[model samples]
Target: MVGFNGKSNSAKQIIHRMRRGPTLPDGGVNFECHCVSHLVASPCGYEFREAIKCQKAASEGELEEGACADELMNFMRCAIRTECFRSW
Candidate 1:
């Protein structure tokens, strides 16, 4: 996503940084160095990682199947909103 400065940051950098350390309450790791502008434009990457965790748990019978759909929908909705509203 493009930062407030209008420079694009690599999705790979964002995703990799998010996955590099311990998980947060949202189930994805947070990085201190991430651009706040990027985070504001796209919150779904974190949510999507969380939903993937939920889906995996459901698939393993650790969580109810019904719960997975809701989380998945949340991920999708956030993704669409982020893409649609992105500054560039």
Candidate 2:
């Protein structure tokens, strides 16, 4: 999907946007960095990294089978607790 910076969001980065934020004054895109500085400096950064690494290594079957589920869950919890993935 397109990010808030006009960059094409990589599949991996797209995972960071659990929910879409309000539209920017201008349209944009998410690339390797996932766009938001909130995430860049998040306390959840480590969890996010672990999840992405798991996602990248999983095969389609493994991914669908939830091989990365734990990692993703950890990241999600961290994101929520830290409010680092806010849509606002």
On lDDT, the candidate that comes out on top is 2
lDDT of each: 0.60, 0.68
Candidate 1 residues lying further than 4 Å off, grouped into runs, are: 1-42, 60-65, 84-88
- Per-candidate TM vs. native? 0.39, 0.53
Root-mean-square deviation (CA) per prediction: 10.9, 11.4
> What is the model-wide C-alpha lDDT for candidate 1?
0.60
lDDT of 1 by residue, 1-88 (tens): 9866788879996687565544455664343424333443356757666676666456555455376777778877887876745566
Clashes per candidate, residues 3 or more apart or on different chains? 0, 11
Per-residue alpha-carbon lDDT of candidate 2 for residues 3-63, written as tens digits (9 for 90 to 100):
8899999877876565454223243322133354445458886786677667766899999
